[model samples]
Target: MKKLLIIGFLSLFFAPLAQAQLGIKGGLNVAELTGREGESSSYKAFYHVGVFYQANIIGPLSIQPEVQYSLQGGNLKSAYTNYDSQLHYLTVPILAKLTVGPVFIEAGPQFGVLLNANQSGNLQVGFTEDGQPAYGNESRPATSNFKRGDFSVVGGVGLKLASNFSLGGRLVAGLNDINDAKNLTGINDPRLQNRVFQVYAAFQFGDGRR
Candidate 1:
């Protein structure tokens, strides 16, 4: 994990050495941790802002790498009946970029290390079908336990205006399961995972060149 972190940083640092340019990027993330079917999950909105460096490795093709502190994952539902989880991570993505005229397309992999997590909503059970209060046992204890080092795939597209500023959207989907337990009381419940979609504006710092 440490090695992967090092590599991601290095990729960002060296990308500028080869016809690379720096940029500031920020986005809106519609994030959620997906659970089993019929579990009823909802996603929340989070924000992310970070800087990136893009290196043109070949004609119309480049390696763009970035390091960003991202706010990801949460639920938006009744506090007493829903689970809400938020995670902060420094993410590094190595992307392959393509440009045609002013439109740019990018796809890549990202590695993230969890910096913090918080429990903002309460968990309850036996709520009525309409989410009304009801008398029943709390389904499970409130849990905040999760793991660090999440790996995922990120891909997006952008439009470059004046070759210096861009507007784009991206989606981040986690590859590893976020659940730390093999089974909750040996119930065989499947693990949950992360997924996020982002839309934002970006500014390139240098003239477009290879």
Candidate 2:
């Protein structure tokens, strides 16, 4: 937790260095599992509030590094089971950005440090206290002991409008495992490593820098 605070502090301190740009972004995200099979297909809304720094290396090429607090996960349901798990990650991505006229594209890898994770749901089995068909077991929220992942891919596209404000979308695909539990069901795959997609609008400061 201390390291997360340090990263967050550095993100703010790097704003005024050189031609660094600061912006606010908010968007919807679609999250799901990848790599292995048998995992359920699900989508969830993920949003992040953060800042970014852009340093131009060439005419139309720049490197933008960002730090964000993101929420990502999915809802799963089986024949007799229903549950939902969400992951809150402090993600950092270093992207290579390209621009042409008003359109721009970026792609890079991201590292996600898990902040908090929880599972909540109610199991439906037989009947309720009233004898009618109802939820079997009451929902009990459980915290997760999740470890941080190494690397992931971060890429997206956007358009610059009037030089100061821009609109874009990006996706973060996790490559490292997030689960550290001992499996008894023979499922060795990690559950915290999921996919996140974001669409946001940015307002760049320091005019004539776009």
Q: On residues 1-210, what C-alpha lDDT tens digit does candidate 2 reach at each position?
A: 999999989966665465656665656777764443434557866677777877776678888888888887767665555666677778888999999999999999888787777766754435666765455545443334456564789889999987788899987788777666433344464455677788888777776376
lDDT of 1 by residue, 52-78 (tens): 888776679888888888988777343
Candidate 1 Cα outliers beyond 4 Å, as residue runs: 1-18, 76-80, 124-144, 181-189
TM accuracy, model 1: 0.76
lDDT of 1: 0.76
* lDDT score of residue 110 within candidate 2: 88
* Model 1 pairs in collision: none
Residue 148 miss distance in model 1 (angstroms): 0.3
**Candidate 2: global Cα-lDDT?**
0.72
Query: For residue 127, what is the lDDT in candidate 2?
Result: 61
